[model samples]
Target: MHTTTPTVIITGASSGIGLAIAETFLAQGYNVVGNARNAARLEQTLAALNCGERFLAVAGDIAEPNTARQLVTHAVQRFGRIDVLVNNAGVFIAKPFIEYDQGDIAQLIATNLMGTVNASQAVAAQMIKQGSGRIVNVTASIALQPLQRVPSAIPILIKGGLNQLTRALALELAPHNIQVNAVAPGLIDTPMHTPETHEFLCGLQPAGRIGRPQEIADAVLHLSQAGFTSGAILPVDGGMSSGVW
Candidate 1:
């Protein structure tokens, strides 16, 4: 570890892609602040990772603006400054557009779109004051390419919104030396999907298999270090965005 290690704040860090990203950064000797709604789950995550003093867990629902504020505040208080932020907290429910009720719409907006906006707003303010920062948002490939089999139009609305906001914020924050980007992943092999459905999901990606959480983690790490890259929506979806595999 360097004498002055940089710090990262990752949302939804208790499991799946978020958990992998947190582990990756911690392994690279960066101070990590992991946030999730379940405090006990966050504690278990911290214990499992065993990053010692370099990792801190902040538990909260990022859909709330106050949670975002508290995440930034706690990170700075513990690590002095936040160098990177990964807005990976989101929800997805696949169903026919007509089947999605108002509650589903509201939940998707809260967790996916507003969560990204709220967290980015808080982190950007701190980054602007520091004069440099990296923000990597976790979106879905469905944002760019719709899947006939998925029938997830309602959820796509929120993730697609994130893609647009990534470019907008990137341009707006470029002058301040902050890079804003997003990663659009395809069907990833997380706990969200059961093993019985893995083979079916695999066929959804052109790569002929589901992606690993570590793969998305690697993409986020790359964008963070890619100084000249901003506003770029890098799709790690194994050709899902490409027509006919």
Candidate 2:
């Protein structure tokens, strides 16, 4: 099967790593549907891509269960089918676990963990119908080593759960011929992290630098093309996973 001209759905596609991944797939001549909460930003980003008829921008909160189904529905309606799904919509807040309120905890889980589940479930259904597909999840290095204290307990909880979800779904989906994988990214220069925070994180890495969104996007692209790979966690962390302190 020639999956080269596949249709991809990427959540959190307004900026950062998600945006980069969308752009990468667009560049590869794949039809792409970008989902984000910010309609204005999504429009601007897609307009800049100049993808002509190869792209569609859908505005919705992936954290909501219905929104994931809507996103997949619109993508399939616009294009024909969905071949790749990138669960990239997530948030990170720094705070002590004790300082977190119920709402904060709920939001983190909804956006990071539940959002991934919803999107993956919806997309996986389509993939199974089609007989083959790929899913690439974006996770954080904090999930690997829980020692790094981000001020917030939410990010840790959400990311940790996300990692577990990734592994579980990979196993369940493999039998359906749908490969599921995740990329554990170290600190990257995105709007989520401030300059000071980036510098601090960079110093903690063996590379002495923070990673780029494009770097992570590159890994996503590779995973999408690797047919025989599944249930894999590829870390594009500038060696941050190698213990950088």
Candidate 3:
């Protein structure tokens, strides 16, 4: 490990792609701050890594603007600086648009879109003060190509908004030397996916396999270090974006 390790703050680190990315960064010798709504689950997940003093868990609802700011503040207080921000906290609702209640739609937008916005804003301000940082937003492949089987409402709207935000923020933050980019992952074998859904998504990909969480984490790591790469959306979806099937 280097004498000085880069510090990263990952939202939704309790499970799925967020948890995998946190583990990967820790393995690479980075000081990691894992943020999630469930304190017990966050503690359990962090304990499993055996990362010792290199990791911290901040428990709160990131969908709230104030909590998002507090999450960044906690990381800064612990690590002195945040070198990377992974806006990976999101909620997915698969019901048809018409079937969605107003509250359900609001919740989906709050967790998926507003969460990213709030976290990015809070962390980017600190990064600007430090004069450099990286922001990686995780989006879904369904945002690129809408699928009928997968209810086209939430993911399509929320992830598309995220992609747009990625580009806009990249341009705005470029002058500060803060790189902003997004990763679009498809059908990763995470707890979020059911066995039947995973198999169906795998069959749609030309690679004939569902992606692993680590695969998406690798892409996140790449974006984190690729200072020259900004406003780009790299798809780690086993060629699902190419429609190679």
Candidate 4:
């Protein structure tokens, strides 16, 4: 059915875990369509990856439905079809539950929850026609098991929603032969966390270390190629979701 190379669309691909995933896919010779708010940064990443023409960077806010549509459209137009969709675009803010305002709640819902929903809808429509596809969503470990050290109820709520969506979509799309899964990371060493904060964040994980971007990327890649695996929520965190140590 597919005459061209398999194509993957990765959101939040400007940096960190998303960027690492993009690079890994590109290295594997898959056509990568990366989306993010910064077109310049996406372009820079594309250049750094050095996978000319195999990579396309689409820049826009994932919170907007239009961006999701554009990403799917671009992937279809450039490549033959969408084989994989990585819903990695998200915003993380940790604070006391009561400290969150209406704006904070709205943003968390828009970017983390709604963004994945919109992108999944667009990609699933295309995948259904093709009769096969894979979706890997990136969520936070706090969504599975809360950490007393980090009181982030608002954002975790959004991530937790994605975890549920992964299972639901996997079943709903199973008949269509589409697979859906999620990867939850804990205290990943990304730009979001400062060097000074690493020491504190590492203590939360039982492994006593923060995860690398490639670690998450590797888990995503594993799920992408795992034919029999779906409705799975893989925790790439360093045993943070197991229990408090």
* Full-model lDDT, candidate 2: 0.85
Instruction: Give the better candidate number (2 or 4) by lDDT.
Output: 4
Candidate 3 displacement at residue 91 in angstroms: 1.4
Model 4, residue 78: displacement in angstroms?
Answer: 0.6
What TM value does model 2 have?
0.94
User: Candidate 4 lDDT, tens digit per residue, 51-146?
Assistant: 878888999988888999999888888887999999999989888998999998998999898889989999999999999999999998889999
Model 4 compared with the native: what TM-score? 0.97
Error of 2 at 57 (Å): 0.7
TM-score against native, each model: 0.97, 0.94, 0.95, 0.97
Residue clash pairs of candidate 4: none
Q: Which stretches of candidate 3 lie over 4 Å from their true place?
A: 1-3
Query: Which of the two candidates, 2 or 3, achieves a greater lDDT against the reference?
Result: 3
Residue pairs clashing, model 3: none
Q: Encode model 2's per-residue lDDT on 104-202: one tens digit a residue.
A: 878888889888999998899889998889999998887776545455456866777777777888889888888888899988899988786776776
The lDDT leader among the candidates is 1
TM match of model 3 to true structure:
0.95
**Would you list the C-alpha lDDT of every candidate in the order shown?**
0.92, 0.85, 0.88, 0.91
Order of models, best lDDT first? 1, 4, 3, 2
What would the per-residue lDDT of candidate 1 be over residues 1-245, giving only the tens digit for each residue? 32368999999999999999999999888999899999999999999998788988989889999999999998888888989999999888999988999999899998898889999999999999999999999999988999888999987888888899999999999999999999999999888999999989987878889999999999999999997999999999899998655
